[model samples]
Each structure stands twice: as C-alpha cells, then as structure tokens.
Target: MPRFAANLSMLYNEHDFLDRFAAAARDGFKAVEYLFPYAWGAADIARRLADHGLQQVLFNAPPGNWDAGERGIACLPGREAEFRAGFSQALEYAQALGCPRIHVMAGLAPAGADRAMLQKTYESNLAWAADLAAKSGRDVLIEPINTRDIPGFFLNRQDDAHGVITRVGSTNLKVQMDLYHCQIVEGDVAMKIRKWLPTGQVGHIQIAGVPMRHEPDLGELNYAYLFDVIDEVSTQSGWTGWIGCEYRPSRAAQPGATSSGLGWLAQRLQ
Candidate 1:
C-alpha cells in the first residue's frame, strides 16, 4: 500500500485551519499537505504537526494575491524579483517545518501577452528556484493544473511541464503529478504515470475522483488499481513519494457520511 497524505486545504473543512492537523490524525492520516501556509507562523504550524505526529508532505509557494486572482507569480514577466523573494520565504517555512517539497505554481499568462516571453520567464524563474532549493536539499515541484479549474493558468499540460523541466535541467525540479488534473486534461492516467515515473521526473503525486473532484471511490478512475500500479512502479524504479489525497470529503459536517465514503481509502491502506 502507498502512503497517503491528506490535503488539509480540501479535507477536514469542519475544523479551523490549524486544528485540521489533529482532525487528520484522528481520521487516520499520517501526513498532510495544503495550498499555502503563509497565514500562520512557521513555528505554530510546526508545533501543530509535531503535536499530531503528522508529516508535512507538501505546500505551495506563495501565489501572490490569491484573492486578487493571482494564482502564482513565477510566469509573470517582470516579476522575477518578486518570485525569487516569494521562493525564499517558502524555503524558510519548508526548512522550519521539515518539509521536503514545495510546489512552485506557474502564474497565469497575461492576456494577449507574448507566449515566448512568458515561457522564457517561467523557465528562468523555475531554474533559479530549483537551484536555491537544491542548496537546502529540497525538491521544487511544478504541477500542471487543469485550465478548467483555473483559466489562464500557465502550466496546464503534462508534456508542457516536462518540456519546462527538461529545459531547466535541474534534478531538484520535478513534476507534481495530480491525477485529477491529468484525467481532465489528458485522460490516460495510468499510462502517464508509468511513463513519467521511470524518468525520475515525478517528485510527488495527488489523486481525486474525476468529473466531480470528490472521493476517489466514486470517480471514473479506479484508484485501487492505480495505487497498485504505483506500488509496482515504485518497487521497480525506486520512486518513493507520498500520494496526496487532494479531494474534498463528501460532507464535512456529516461524520457518518464522510466516514462511509472513505471506505475505499481504508481498504487500500489495509
């Protein structure tokens, strides 16, 4: 069985942000990840994780003003200085939290902007980020989010992400493969995993049911089979990383309903 990390940003909504660590532990999760941790002090976040004995598997670097619609600043031309500063801040948190990976979100492409310019800035920014992270012995990840969920997101396809990673030519930079987004963007989920896992470019993975982004059991994808495939591939290729449970629970307030729906996850762990 693969180790699963609960995405606190999506799961355990019934609890407050800091309190979600305890909730995840009570619910049988040994690891957790989230969108961002900038709101709280690193010491507080670290204290909560230690209190719950949960590993902080992943968290994104600052995405600029999320409320103002800035998903990330890396790909935004002329924001190189800002992106570097944001990365340094994220690294501080990761080191203090003992977290090993940070997802560097590629900001949205400016409307009618020069495509070539955008890609160049993105590649340069990521290379710089990867170099900085490498010095700290941390890995930088790039996730290809589905455009439907966030229109104009700079990184939206697996191949495109691979191209950027290849161009960056840094071992510290790898793909954060999110199955939910892959299913929506390309649909050959298992094949893609197999293809990428061996390249050693995949640093982390996430899963959610397709079409609804709900519990994996109700999705079009067979997570059970996929998890088995992942184990087999890992054994053969030495790919060891957490498969983040980045899905929203069916009902946050209804304990019975959520627990019943999580049966599929329990079976896999068993």
Candidate 2:
C-alpha cells in the first residue's frame, strides 16, 4: 500500500500551522506535507514532526514574492540569485525536518516571453537544484501544475515535466505527479500513471478531487480504482514513495469542526 500523507496546509485548517502536526497524527496520518515551511523555524518544525512521529513527505521550495503574485522564480529570467537563495533556505528546512523530497515550482513566464529561453532557464535551475539536493541524499521534484489553476505557470503538462527531467539529466530529479493538476490539464489519469509510474521517474504523487480540489471521494476521478492502479504500479516497479493527500477538506468552510474528511483514506487502508 502506498503511504498517504496529509497536506496540512490545505487540511486541518481548524488549527494553527504548528498545531496541525498533532491534528494529523490524531487523525491517523503517519506522514504529512505542506506547501511552504519558511515562516516557522526548522528546528521547531523538526521537533513537531519527531513528536508526532510523522514523516515529512514533501514540500515546495519558496515561490518568490507569492503575495505579489509571483508563483516561483526558477523559470524567470534575471532571478537566478533569488531562486538559488530560496532553494538554499528550502534545503535547510528539508535537512532539519528530514524530508526526502522538495518540489521546485517553475514560475510563470512573462507575456510573450521567449519560450525556448524559459525552458533553458528552467532546466538549468532544475539541474542546479538536483545537484545540490543530491549532495544531501534528497530528491528534487518538479510538478506540472495546470494553467487553469495557475495561469501562465511555465510548467503545465506531463510532457513538459518529462522534457525538463530529461534535459536536466539528474537521477536526483524526479516528477511530482499531482492528479488534480493532471486531470485538469490532461485527462485519462490512470493511463498517465501507468505510463509514467513505471519509468522510475515519479518521485511522489498527490491527489484531490477534480473540478473542486476537495476530498478525493467527491471527485469525478475514480480514486479507489486509481489507488488500485497505484498499488499495481508499486508492485511492479517496487516504488516506495508516499502518496500525498493534497486536498482541501469539504469542511474547510466550516471552522472549528472536528472532522478529518479522511473517509476515502480510511476505506483505502481497509
């Protein structure tokens, strides 16, 4: 069975960021992931993970100036310094938290920007990240987020992710396959997983209901069937990676509710 991790950034919104660790453990999650952990000290985050006995499955490298609408800096021109610095900080957190993987987001391309140049910059940055992460025995992941959710985002397709991985040519570099983004950008997700998962390229997988980004049980995607497929892929490929539950709870709108929304995960484990 694939180990499932709660995406604390989206789930367990009823508690403070630091407190979400205990919430996830209380709800029976052995692993947890989040978007960014830069705000809190690494030592504090590490202590929480150790206390809760939760493995840090994944997290994103800092996206530059997120409040100002900058999604990431890896693909942007003239932001190499910012990208490297952000990655250094992320590496520190990953090391402190004992995280094995980090997702490097490709920032949005400028309007009418040179596509080839963007690809080049993206590949170069990924290579750099992969090299640095390899030194610490950690993997670097690149996710192909759909443009619908993140308009103008440079990396927006599986093929694009494949190209970047191929161009970078690093064993430490792998794909972060988020089913929500994949279903929105390119449907036929089961086929995509079967095709991609066995290649030893996928380092991690994330899931949320399509169209709403809610609990997987409410999605158009047949997650139960998809989980079976994931199992088969794991059996065949000997994959031991985590499947991150990166979804918003249906009760997110209802604050202070004592619900976990883990019905899908519970059924799967059964």
lDDT on C-alpha atoms for all candidate structures = 0.91, 0.90
Runs with alpha carbons beyond 4 Å of true place in candidate 1 = 253-260
Candidate 1, 167-252: lDDT as tens digits? 99999899999999999999999999889998999999999998898899876999888998999999999998998988877765
Q: In candidate 2, what are the lDDT values of residues 121-172, reduced to their tens digit?
A: 8888889899999999999999999988899999888987987788789998
Off by over 4 Å in 2: 255-260
User: Could you give the C-alpha RMSD of every candidate to the true structure, in order shown?
Assistant: 1.2, 1.1
Q: Model 2, poorest ten-residue lDDT window?
A: 252-261
Cα-based RMSD of candidate 1: 1.2
- Evaluated against the true structure, the overall lDDT of model 1 is 0.91
Model 2 steric clash total: 0
